[model samples]
Target: MKNTYIPITMEVEKNYFETSDRMIKTLRLKFLDERFDFEPGQFCEFSILGKGEAPFGIASSPFDKAGLEFSINRAGVVTKAIHELRIGEKVGIRGPLGNYYPVKEMEGYNVVVIGGGFAFTTLRSLIEYMLNPERRGKYKSIKVIYGARNPGLLLYKDLLENWEKRDDIGTYFTIDTKVEGWNKMVGFVPTITEEVAPSPENCYAIVCGPPIMIKFTLPVLLKLGFPKDKIVTSLERRMKCGIGKCGRCNLGEFYVCNDGPVFNFEQLEKLPKEV
Candidate 1:
């Protein structure tokens, strides 16, 4: 495929508020048009020039060309700077890079997507593509089990509420600790995931979250008989440049910035276990 390009002058950018702090800050952005080609689960690197760059998934669905969105957490240096930027201030960006979740191969299969806070970003991409009106029959059931540190931390409450009310996909949530105003399940992600175990037969599972949460959840998924290869994931790492040259984020021979920010559990098992 020919390399598609987005000139720096037209890179997507937008303003968003932290509807709450429990999760991460929201970035309202633009994807240009229905013509901007980006596969679900792919990410772009956001740059602040002086401060640095951080990688973020293009969270909003491809179907919504009005804008692209980044669901970011104010974690370290680059992200911290991102959280402070004002609307209309230009931030450098390049790409909708790396492999995206494969919804095409997923056609006609039962699907279960497990996400947490910011990592839930890619899952939204997959869900959006699956739910688009012209694409709905591409998959069977799609279930989401998402959570955060607490009630205040859930990202995209407006979207989640809308998703929860949908008949097409089943959604559930949990938190690491209890919140006074919260009404959903309470416990660590893996704990609750084991309880709400969606079937693995005739299905595929995709998980993205804190490393520790993944550390525990993968085994639970295995126990539930999800095929290791079919258990997909979008790996997380510190990313400076969206391209492969940067050496900061590597797992043995794999560079998270390039070869993948997205990999299946099967691919991950063959790599250095730290991933």
Candidate 2:
């Protein structure tokens, strides 16, 4: 059996800043062996020699053959080390670990994607997967509502522009406040979500963002008629070990590292009130 604790080495093919502030960087890693197969919403433990390891969502789609992508925010020591990594440097990847978004179950329904700040990484994976030609026919309408503090903080600007030009999906980009030369909506993510007001009928709404953003957004989704079971979110916070062996990432009886990182509102409700 493949050892979950041992990491495989992969070369960093590309690494660059995602935002103008330089706090967040996107890394593309080339696989040395057969590529690790993973669904969207899954995360991997990224490791650097002497620097330590951290968990981050895989930002590239399953159909993306070039490499695995991770958008990392320079928040702590490991992440700071990750940001300093150069192209051609070797790194360790522990897994396509943890549970993933229910792509198969969501196939027949319309998809509404909501994101904020850098948390949009995995959401991007899900979107790209659903937009692929082979998968497009499986789902109905797709709508995306994303927001960042400012235009400069938005991740994947080029892809967002391309998505805006596509007719197959509806994209709503927003910011926390208005600024000169900005043409997108002016407001927070939850506000924009309420404004976009995607119908919940035969739909699944996937949300990922900071706790504050999600705290307010859930009420809006519920008010707009999304069932608790149909509203999915990722609680990837505080995850140290990517496997369930560590007890740190639990929410009631569920371990975020094993049982989730992804959970519907109905499931979350059953967890401890701290969630």
Candidate 3:
């Protein structure tokens, strides 16, 4: 087999503070002698030479030609190092890897997007793709339900605010607890999902979050008549190699990097509970 590595050098075009401890960076990479092309829900392995490499979902829409964005939380050594880097710094990108969300198949069906915390990265890409003017009419309607531990921790606050005001898509935002001057929904994501109870008819649901949120949310989706095949999610695993050969990101024999980072609930049901 050929070595599936790209010696692409990318520069950090910009960076923004998402939270006190987290930063989102946009990197400009060239592939095929042009901007890198990737689909929603796919990931790229980022390397900072001596620091190390880590897999992060592609947070920008495929239609976006600006650059690729990644949400990095300051929770680990590698990430801590990455967080300290400045704009114009150089880094290595070795992907556009893994399977992507079934966007084409979702045409003509309503989409329910459920997300929580930082896990909402790729879902943001999915939403942007769905909302694009060129691709907007392909689907019926879009309902977004997203939440974070608190208002301060929410990612993409600016974009979420604008989305809430748009009539084309139905947007719901929640925080785990109530605070002064807050007016939107205040509750766990699963609770809000059950309350909204978006009809499962002709709809496809995509969910991503911490494990506990997913565990509780899936049952609600099923209760609301969403078939397992129609519900999708991306798994967060420690994938050392973007390829399946690493043997680290396996769920019952399926390598999350190779087989999926995106999988429908029906496909998930056939895998081990450990994923």
Candidate 4:
């Protein structure tokens, strides 16, 4: 196995704002020694030299193998430095680290994806994967319930618009409060989820968002009769080493970076609530 500590240099190809303080950036990376294959919910440790590094989920689909994308929030020194980076600037990437969503197991089952705020990144990847021509046949219905504080804050507008027009998948978009010029669903994610009320039979629910959103959404999923194992989620944590060496992301011997970032509701139930 290759040493996980060292990082491969990749160049920033493009970047654009998703929210006032969040940016979605694309990177062009070359992995000659190892295959760059990764699952939808996996993440990479993005590093800006002399600044710092942070774990960000891979926001692009695995089908797009040549390039990588990340949705980063401008909340800290490292991300602020990342925001200043121009096209063609080089940065260090030490992943596709962490576990991934259980796409293989989900084959032949309906999938419902729920997301909120800027945390929609990995969910976007999962949606793209499920929508891929080769992969779509293996899955049944695909429904996405995505929301942010406002219309301007939603990520992947182009794709969402296309999904809205397509009959292949059901798409619903919402904001926390009603805004002028917006005519789609308007409510908090949990409320909108209750209204939509997708069935739990033979369906897998994958959720990723802020902690509070997860807290409230779990009950809704349970009330809908989703089994613990069928309800999956991806977690965000303060991860450093991108491997088990760092103790920061541990939850009772489970390292979020190496062991997870992706876990089913049953698995999460067994762990401490700190995450």
Candidate 5:
């Protein structure tokens, strides 16, 4: 009952919010008239023909229908190809394809988003979507705890600033190294999250990051009383096809491209530990 790829074209590109030491957050590709209706936490498969295709989260929110954007880090071969795309360049695209985060089900519940390094790319979409009035009232509280190696390594500085100013959302940031102007928490995300100790009662936690970060945070969330189903995540694995047909992104009986890029802790237990 589900279809796999789509033919989309490039629309625009933007600069990084600021300079970083080890990582760069490029507001890279914008696909035009994508009509790619993806909710927060969903991904699309992108290709450069011979260069090969890779799955990427839809970084822009569902609120912005003008186009879709992916905030990518210069990490791998495929990402390098994606980063090299020039404005007006047409890269092959095939999806808004994976399962999305559950925004409505989170209604009236406190929401916590745990992001590490590049995982901010995906969580940013959910943050923006929840910020919109068309959907804002659904959640009671919003807290974002994000981290990277240093201040420069952090993504979306401008968006983080705006989120800090919002009375409705609680935003906290940290870096592994203390920068010249930095004065927030100091440590890994899991420790800082444990320090904040958000209540898990009637709450939902959306976590995404490097494997280690997720591994550390899960135990902390469970200790904080979040049930397995109340904690969700989007796991990344190797992929060529955006659809499940490739069999490359599978875990036992499930495929990341089909059953989820998004899943609850209960479901994740059945899959191999990504870490």
Candidate 6:
């Protein structure tokens, strides 16, 4: 088995700001050795040598041969160090750690993707995986409901505009409040979700966002008749050792790094209300 504690070396392929504030940045890292394959909803331990490491979701699609992607918020030491990195800098990546979204199980079912703010990282992975030319036929209709504090805060602006032009997927973008030039929907995530009211029949809903947004959004999905088992979400926690030995990311008996960052509503119900 591969040693979970050791990190593989990678080179920073691309680095850019995802939002206007520059608080969140996106990194595309090229593998220096054999690539570590990963699926959507999985995360990696990104390290900057002496600065320490942090767990971030893999934001690129599995079929993306260019490199792995991570969209990180400039919240603390490790992330701040990461933000300072320039193109061609070397870095450490520990894993394609944690479980992934159930794309295999989602085959033949319509998918509803709901996201807010930075948590859209993995949801982007899921969307890209499903929308790939070879994989698109495995799933039915796909709809996305995404919101941010404002239009400027949304991630993947170029891709969002491109997706808006495609007829294969239904994309809805919203903001917390209206702005002068903003022509799209204006409302909170949960409110926009309720407005979309995607059908539960033959479908699964995947949600990821801030805890507060998730707390209210679940009820809207449930009210729309989605079964607990069919509604899924990814969790964020204070993870130290990406392999789950640190015990900081445990929810009941499960470790977010090992058993999941992904869990359905039925599975979440068995854990404490921390989620």
Backbone clash count for every predicted candidate, in the order shown: 5, 0, 0, 0, 0, 0
Model 2: per-residue Cα lDDT over 21-139, one tens digit each: 99999999999884578999999999999999899999999898767999999988899999989999999999999898999999899999999999999999999999999999999
Identify the candidate with maximal lDDT: 6
**TM-score winner between candidates 1 and 6:** 6
Candidate 4 lDDT, tens digit per residue, 1-275? 77788888777777777665355443444443445778899999889889989888888989987778887777789988987888878888888898899999999999999999888888999999999998999999999999999887888888899999989899889999988999999998988899999999999999988899989999999999999999999877787798888698888768888889899989888888786
Off by over 4 Å in 2: none
What is the Cα-based TM-score of model 6? 0.98
lDDT of each: 0.78, 0.93, 0.86, 0.86, 0.81, 0.93
Decide which is better by lDDT, 4 or 5: 4
Candidates' TM-scores?
Answer: 0.89, 0.98, 0.94, 0.95, 0.92, 0.98
**Which pairs, if any, clash in model 3?**
none
Predicted candidate 6, C-alpha RMSD? 0.9
Clashes of 1: 5
Tell me which of candidates 4 and 6 scores higher on TM-score: 6
lDDT of 4 at 208: 87
**Residues 30-144 of candidate 3: C-alpha lDDT, one tens digit per residue:** 3334356788999989888888888888888889776788887766777877777787788787778899889999999999999999999999999999999999999998999
lDDT of 6: 0.93
The weakest ten consecutive residues by lDDT in model 5 span: 15-24
lDDT of 1: 0.78
- Name the runs in model 1 displaced over 4 angstroms: 1-7, 10-14, 31-35
Candidate 5: count of backbone clashes, pairs at least 3 residues apart or interchain: 0
